[model samples]
Target: MTKAHHIIIVGGGAAGLELATKLGNKLGKKKLAEITLIDSSRTHIWKPLLHEVAAGTLDSSEDQLEYLAQAQWNNFRYRLGRVIGLDRESKELLLEPTLNDEGEEIIPERRFSYDTLVFAVGSLSNDFGIPGVKDHCLFLDSTEQAERFQKNLLNRMLKAHSQSKPIEQGQLHVAIVGAGATGVELAAQLHHVTRLVSAYGLDSIDPAEDIKLHVIEAGPHILPALPQRLSDAAMRELHRLGVTVHLNQRVVEINAAGIVAASGVIIPAAIKVWAAGIKAPEFLKDIAGLETNRINQLVVKRNLQSTRDESIFAIGDCAACPMDDQGNNVPPRAQAAHQQAMTLSRTLVRRLKGEPPLDYTYRDFGSLVAMGHYTTVGNLMGGLAGSMMVSGYIARFVYLTLYKMHQAALYGWPRAILISLLHFLRKGIDPQVKLH
Candidate 1:
């Protein structure tokens, strides 16, 4: 039999998994193409929810999707390994050997040939060469990191509650750098979770008094990328929740004890989180001679094809795609990634029939920052009606629908509804927050 057209997608992130599922359903199900997805990890979790995972508001163990099971159901093959090298000339990519916790190799180094390749390898927190930040600060880029933060948070809380001594200045203080959506929402979530923790038998530690959440932002306003109106609203909510917001404070260094600001301000913190900025992985820079941007993102054309090679395409945060002619690129957001996945799925299907590709256009549904169960705030961009600021239950409902939409895209509406129900049922029996 003639060999099927092999399509390989690297990175089992929001964009990569969605694209893989769609293409697998359209082509792989019919044996028209062989679909394979490669990732360093075996499970996938929505990137935006990492904050909740870190704060213990969301249990990642129940939410994370197993790539192997997903691949089996979606008619795609899942390979667990990191892409270390790419050879455009040979139409092949090399994966490093997969290793276990003890450093024993599981899968040997392998190379896979692809007739078409798509890169959706997401971005990571960029420290910008900040001194001691990497060594002292925790990041919420992955589930592993989030879980680590959660465990550390629980242990610290337990220790604080068990001790008869007074809480030290930095004992229960959490210093979060960057007041973007992640930092702001995390501050709010952690604040709410602290109250829950205190209520759940940790009464010795006062949520408002002992659990201090500090947000340090170099920008003049929180959520600098967002409108000033939304940022102001979020700030008000955060302040009401007793989160200390330090604006225009540039962090010069981070140490085991705390963060030092350029303005001679030092914030003592037992746990520090860095959510300052993001950049595509360093390895993507000019990989296989592909054009890359300053942030190491693959420079892709309007149709999402690499500038240097047509057979290779990139989407999601890894692809520096143009938004318009004004020298602007699409922002790295979940909505942008979702749109790219939808557009790329169509483009690939059309390519099978020798048809022209479809271009990806970002749709601004606005941004929502969910602050645990306290409240959700955001701006709603209605194309013709203009932007409207929303908060409270309406905004919370909209914020939740975004996640529901993602679930529907993956499992269809029925299964997504069932999954939602299962989560609801699980919440009744399980603690609101992860205890151990």
Candidate 2:
């Protein structure tokens, strides 16, 4: 009897989870292939929502998807383990043993053979060798880190409010090290949430007087990745909200008190957030002798298959696919990852049927940045055969549609609509920002 072909997918982020859902529904139930998804965490949360999670605007308990539950619904196997090594010749993936919080072995190290493999481990914040950053700053790369910051923020506020004497100096100061989408949105959301938190019985603290937010960026202006007009609009809105904007300031160190810039200026703060850059996990550098870029992203061909091995594929932030059109590589963003996931899904389906897979070409759909419910700005492309700028409520509507698009891709139309309605109903009943 012929062995059943197996397809293994490592990582369960936006791309991996969507791909697994699609492929499993297509092949797993039909008994054509065994679909397996391995991830370190048992639940999945959209990475873009991490900033809001950190700021307490979104409750992770309701938003996160349980991997095992999803696997059961989507007809796929979920394995809880980290991929430690790969044996190309044997076509087996070596998984490291998993340990629980109490140091008990939850899953032992084992090998899972696959006819095809897909890697979508995603990326994390890049400190760029800045001194004291790893020790003093918080990065919203995962749900755990976001929860830690939120808890710390709540504790700091309570301690300051309960103090007998006057509010101490630098009590609610927050320094954000980047002015990109994450940093800008986080700063704006924090401003709103801080006010809400104070109004919700933390009477000793004043949002306008006690809280301080500073956004430091090395570029000439904030939101450098977006169009100048949109960036200007966001900057103006942030300034109107009383957020100090420090442009062209490169952080050299993240001291306990604050951040030190290259210009010899020190900014003091009670909490610091590092949101500047991102790089793939360190382990990918030597994985299977693959050629990786400076940030340790695997180099892949136009077909989205790794150059070192055709049977292995990568997508999302972990793969570096060059673009000859602009003489630059694809930018690491949620849209890029979602697009790549769709492309790979189609290609792999064709390959399963013994047909040639097509080359993956990235379409440049413009970018959008949201500053909470206050406002939104973006550039729209492929509109009426041209591109145009958009802002305000209309842009906010479009911004929300992007998330819906992601949901539609994974859950289909009916389920996506139901889930969205449920989310809205829950939001109306619960507090907008998490207080605890």
Candidate 3:
């Protein structure tokens, strides 16, 4: 009998989970390959929705998919463990022992041999070693972080509302230290949701009067990666929503009270959110002498295979793949990850059939910025014959379709349609923002 081919995937994120589902349905069902997905968490949530989760605009419990349930339904095996190291020579992945909240070992440290290994561990916030940042500032990199911010926000609002005296200084001040997509969206969403929260009988504290939002960026402008016109439109909308935009102001320190700019000026804030940049996990940098970029993304070839070992493949935010057009590198975005995942699915299938995997190319699908109910602005590339700028409700619709597209990729047409309908139906019954 032929030995069963084993494929080990580390990280059940957007890219990893999708790839696993596709492969499991295609290969695992036929017994052509054994597919296993390893992740630290038992649930999976798209990382892009983290901003919405952070602002309490989206309840995570309703949307989060259980990894175990998904794996069982999709014909894949799920292992709960953190990958600590890789043994390229031995073709084994070293999984660290998993512990429960009570400090008891849940899963023992073990090694999993694999014919092919794919790393899709994703990226995390890069604090850049700023003073007091790790302890004082919140990051929206994980579900826990976003939920923590949401809980803190609700508690702050409730405390202020219950106060017998007038609102004190710095009552609900939020300082977001980045004008990137995540920070900007969070700022706008907070403005819209906080007002909605106030309407639900948090009457003593007025959302507009008591809550203040400060968006700080070291760059000269917000949405620096987007076109100037779209960025300008976003700036205008943010200003209309009473968000203070601070440009060219680098945050040198994050204290318990607020953030201190490099210029020595201190901005008083009750909460601070850091969303400036991202870097692959530090562990990947020295992982078995693999070639990595400055941000610790594994250097992969055009075929998405690691430079050190072709058996090892990397994708999503963890891989540094070259851009064909500019000779630069692919940008880490949800779309890029989705595209790479699709490409790798086909490539892996071909490889299983004793065929060479094809090189992966990233296609630019343009970008969109959603600013809650205020507006959405974006440029449409690969849409018309040329690029076109879109704004307002139309842009908002397009922006939402992006998330739907992700759902379609993962769950197919029927499930995606049902999920979308369920979300819409829940909107009528639930408050727009989670007040508690």
Candidate 4:
């Protein structure tokens, strides 16, 4: 009797979940391969939607896909643990003990052996060792964190509305550190949704005038990674919406009530979110002798395999795969991960047949920044678009389509369509923002 190949995947983000589902449906269903997915969390939510989750514009529960449910529906076995160590020699991956809310260990440390291993553990915000950041700021790195921010925001809104005194300066101020897509989108969502919440019987608080948003970017402008044109458009929209843009101001320290800029400006804020940068979880740094970059991302060859092991592969933001001779690794974006997942899905099937894995070269289709219901701006690359700039409704439609594509990957087109319909219906039945 031949031994069934065991494939183990760590993490449950966009790349990890999609790859597991694909292999599980394709290989596990036939009993040719045993597929297992391990993630620290029991549920998976699209990372890009985290800003909406944080701003209370979207209820995370409505969108979260439970891993156990997904595993049962597909053929993959799901494990509730986080990979902490990897033994390449024994082909065993070590998992840290699972802890409950009270900090009691539920599941003890465990290890799983695999014929093939994949790491898509994703990333966390890089605080850059800034003092007080870890203790004071909320991050949108996970669903729980985003929901925490939402609840806190709701509490503040309710308190301000029910109180007799007028809202004071910085009482409702939100200081978002970083002008990247996450920071910018969050500012827009919070502004739009907070106002909507105020209208829903919290009429004592005027959303238009009560809330103050301060976006602090260390760079010269917002959306520093995107095209300047798109950045300018987004900047204009943010200003039009009354958002305060603080460019080239570096936050040196975060305190209980505010942050101090490098220029010694004290910005008072009720809430502070660090969305500046990302680095892979620290555990990835040289784990089991695997090569990694400065950001702790596993270094990969052109084929997306770890530099030290052919049996292991890395993808998404966790892998430092080079894009070209320009010393540019693939940008950590959802689109790049989406494309890489598709390519690697095919490559894995080929590998099972003793075929060589294919090399990856990223295709930069475009980038889009959605500013809530106001508008969207981005540029399209290649194929008839040729640097064509798109804005307003066209860009917004495209932005919505991106999420639809991710949904299709996980649930297939038929179910994705049904999900979309349900969300549309929900708009009429429920409030646009998460109030409670």
- The alpha-carbon RMSD values of the candidates against the true structure, listed in the order shown, are 1.0, 1.3, 1.3, 1.2
Q: Pairing residues by index, what is the TM-score of model 4?
A: 0.98
lDDT of 4 at 23: 88
Candidate 3 lDDT, tens digit per residue, 156-229?
Answer: 99989888999876779999999999989999999988888888898888777789999999999999888888
Residue 173, model 2, lDDT? 95
Span of 10 residues, lowest total lDDT, candidate 2? 322-331
TM-score of each model, paired residue for residue:
0.98, 0.97, 0.97, 0.98
Error of 4 at 101 (Å): 2.6
Candidate 4: regions farther than 4 A off? none
Model 3 TM-score is 0.97
Candidate 3 regions with alpha-carbon error over 4 angstroms: 325-327
Q: List pairs with backbone clashes in candidate 1.
A: none
As for candidate 2, its clashing pairs are: none
TM-score of 2: 0.97
Question: How well is each residue in 366-427 modelled by candidate 4, as lDDT tens digits?
Answer: 88998987888888788865787899999888888989998899999999999999999999
Q: Write the per-residue lDDT of candidate 2 for residues 1-436, one digit (tens) a residue.
A: 8876788999999889988988888888887788999998989998998988998988888778899988898888999998888888889899989999999998889999999899999999999999999999999999999998898888888998899988856778999999999999999989988888888899989878889999999999998877888798899999999999899999999988999999998898989999998999887886878788899898888888998887888889998987676668887888888888888878888878887667877787777888877888888888576667888988888888887888787778898899989998998898878888
Choose 1 or 4, whichever is better by lDDT.
1
Q: In model 3, state the lDDT of residue 377.
A: 87
Candidates in order have lDDT scores of 0.92, 0.88, 0.90, 0.91
